[model samples]
Target chain A: MKIKTIPKYTVYLLLVLAASIPLFFDIKMPNKPVDSSAATFKSLMTLEKGDTVLLGTDWTGSTRGESKAELIAILRILMRKEVKFAMWSSADAQSPRCAQDVITEVNAMMKKEGSREYKQWEDWVQAGFYPNSDVAINNVGQDVKKMFSPKRGTDSTGKLRSVMESPVLEKIQKIEDFKLVIDVTASKTSDFHVQFISSHKVPMIFAVTGVMVPETDVYYNSGQIAGFLGGLKGVYDVEVMMDKGLNVPDKDGKIEVASTKVTDQIAGFPGKDNTGSGSKYYPTLHFALALMIVLVVIGNVEMAMARKGAKNS
Target chain B: MNLELYYALSKAAGVVVTVGLFSVLYKENKFYRFCEHLFLGLAAGWAAVGVWTESLHTIWYDRMMGTVDEAGKAQSGGHWIYAALLPVGFMSYMVFSKKHNWMARVPLGIVLGVWSGQQIQAYFDTYGPQVRAGMKPIIGTSGFLVPGADSGINPQVIAANVYWSQAISNFLFMFTLVSVLSYFLFSFEVKNKIILKVNIMGRYLLMIGFGAIFGTTVMMRFTLVIDRMYFIWNEFFYKTLFHGK
Candidate 1:
């Protein structure tokens, strides 16, 4: 066989190696925060300390590659702003647990940094998994209190209490009362939420995997969603904005991190551990893509050379 | 088992399962099938438990049977009217019965009615804003780029000052939207040459859209594999085995 027609296993091994080698080195990547991501960051920045947001987490380990980083970056920003949030899931049974695990991981990172620990009941509440996203989401829009009255959480004193009674949700009588609602999902939960909740006048955003990007764009462009983090790039957008800030002016009076939606540069946590999945996977993805392109070029070149030789022969 | 021991065991089991699933890439094997079955079983079990704990426990069971306080006294009064829903829900399962298959339509009809009732509002809520947004003006008055702009200027004013560049983009958008809509006109023979060209343009535009979607899907799939690789090397090898930082 020709060099270009290498064994399938050899090709797979080469691709794997290409994808893995970059993990060892720290690559400096240029960050251009998209307008949509900037809008999402701007929306979150608008929330004052102690203000509440609703988080609909509908992803499991399946899409962890993209969703985890999104959750991490968004949570880091939310935690840094001292913004309290209430979380729930409607797509899958394990989604709530997945959210719990990510939050726990992020909290540990926060603890290591000596930041204020985000307390349950006091700061945030987890309204465990709910079935039937459409009706449940509609219920959330119609009767927020009754919808969440059943979910329980632990107070500061370790006492089990209804989630609605928690500081994170005590004043949330309706869906619109929450400063914003963000859906981090791998399923159609974002659409269901849009159909039921966003229609009720609540500002919404999405943190979705890449495949959902094209579809999610319609919502973002339509103004139904405040903004969105689409796929891994969206995670990178959050990371970049958090590092440099949106529309922040440089020493030369130039706006460093520019975004169409944002007016002025709001600074991000410069030195902290804001990098997550996007940071880690992005460079490796480049290497894989480069390999794919190289293989395609080589194959085409080989085929062209063969055709030329045959004509001459 | 102790917490630490349990954690180690869980990690080991996860590694095994991950490898088992990945084995299919090499060749068809029992390991892959076992892992697949394991996932399906776990998902089924978890969903069953979740339905009771997350849904039925509060929405139906507690609502119908009421709740008791710590002292065993009735805390919330139960409404027995909720019991009627049980038969309605159970009727949906009659889809499998030959004799009672028609009864399944009762629940299905109710579902369709509710679903149909919500569609009007749902359609408007979803597409109303989109349709409005699609009406982009193909004219501009202000300069191409707004320099030194700050938060002082009203966004509406800025939006109103559409430049030639913005005008061209909007014109392109309007054209694409119209051409795509025109492509769906398949009722009559399109004799007009202009209409046929527009129809072809729509087909080409749709292909471009699908191409973009397919590209994104490819990226997503690659990211999934990259994540698995990260899990294997960073989490399993470096952290779990070598205890590397």
Candidate 2:
């Protein structure tokens, strides 16, 4: 049979094998974090303990593979630094649940490792979900206290109190009061944030899907966002940075991750649970990519041969 | 139900449904249809409950009727004015009525009015900086390459002077931007030869951008497939069924 006439199911089966086989083997691929990812790490490292930040969790199960990893990595950093964050969603009704699940999973990992388990109302708080993306974000930018006053969170006593009374948001009278704003999104909520909140001169960061990287780069280049994490590659970059810090040398005087974008040396959690979905799924993704490249080359060669044969006949 | 047993059963059901959905790759079947309908129904039901509990109950109902503390003391007074919004929101459903269809436009118009007002400010907030950032110095003042550009971009040293490499990069970016903008000259006939060539260049540049986007999209789709494989093989088969967690 001609290479051009390969059965479709055969290709699908090959893809399934290529994708699943890599998970069985433990492989660590050499990686260089991109400039944008390096910048995002630097921005996160700049946050100090007890500083509150606004997090917009605007992703659902549809983009869980990437968004979940991104959220876990960022949450690890925040929990390690004891940074307080108030998270809400403006994209979908299910986004808050997806993000909360990842947080719970990360907290479980931390608990298993004998680390501090981040608690609600003290370390972090959920501000709930808003349906209208544009108007919700606009209302947030206009009057944060007024917008969140109606929403309630449980205190240490387990009594429902206004979200404004939560420790994470008590000091946050306006959007500018927050140290930073982060949006992990698979939708247009990031654009809405730029429209309303960026004008307030608040520092913003985004962790977006692969398709959003190109457009998000425009915002990064224009100085609208301080930095951004893009796709699985971005997640992998953060994972590597977390394992070996940027421009920081180990006890053996070896710098595993280095970047010129940041001059100050930042240290990483060396002996910790740093690896997540990014580390696990990235190498497998490479195998799938290689299969695609091989198939493309074969298809091209087959096309040329078929054209030559038709002309000669 | 036991939590462990519940989780195990959940994973087993997930595996069955996943296989059922994948059967569509072979041929159209009832299993695929069943899974599709199940997913739609679940999503719709969840959204309905989520909207009411997460949003409407807290934001609207609580605010309108106010709330009481455990001691039976009034926490906040009820706002009777908020009750008016109910009818206005329900007016959106008037589109189904033949006689009162025009009333639906009122709420839509209000939304549009609010949205358009915000857009006027949002337009500048979003695009103005991008336009400003487009302006770049095409002349090099410093060395051929920025100090640490080879290792990684050093923001400090590069901000003071435009290196030769940056100049060339900036020139290319500017050219592409101008050419692409010129390509959208749809008002009049393009008689100018130089513009026509630039228009062609614009098309090529646009194609390159679109190619990069398409490549990223393909990578994203592959990641999704790989994630599903991980879920099926490792998450379900190895961990749950074989007790390998």
TM-score of each: 0.95, 0.97
lDDT of 1 by residue, A42-67 (tens): 88878789889999999999999999
Best by TM-score: 2
lDDT of 1: 0.85
**CA error at residue B108 for candidate 2, angstroms:** 1.0
lDDT, candidate 1, B1-245, per-residue tens = 89766766787788889889978889999989999999999999988998888778877888898876556777577899999998999999999999999999999999898878877867787788899889887987887765333445765677667777788888998999999999999899899999999999999999999999988898888888889888888887888777787
Per-candidate Cα lDDT values, in order, are 0.85, 0.89
lDDT string for model 2 (A1-313, tens) is: 2455778898999999999999898899999888789889988988999999999999987888889889999999998988999999988888888999999998998898788999999999989888999999999999999989888888999788898999889988899999999999999999999999999999999999999999999999889999999999999999998888887766786667876555567777889979888999999999999999998988898888988888898
Instruction: Calculate the i-RMS of every candidate, to one decimal place.
Output: 2.1, 1.9
Model 1 chain B worst lDDT window (10 residues):
B146-155
Each prediction's DockQ against the real complex: 0.58, 0.64
Model 2, B1-245: lDDT tens digits are 99988999988887788888889999999999999888889889888998888888888998999987667788888898889999999899999999999999989999999999999979999999999999989999988966653344556656778889989999999999999999899999999999999999999999999999999998888888888888899888898889895
Model 1 misplacement above 4 A: A1-4, A157-159, A302-313, B146-157
Which 10 consecutive positions of candidate 1 chain A have the poorest summed lDDT? A1-10
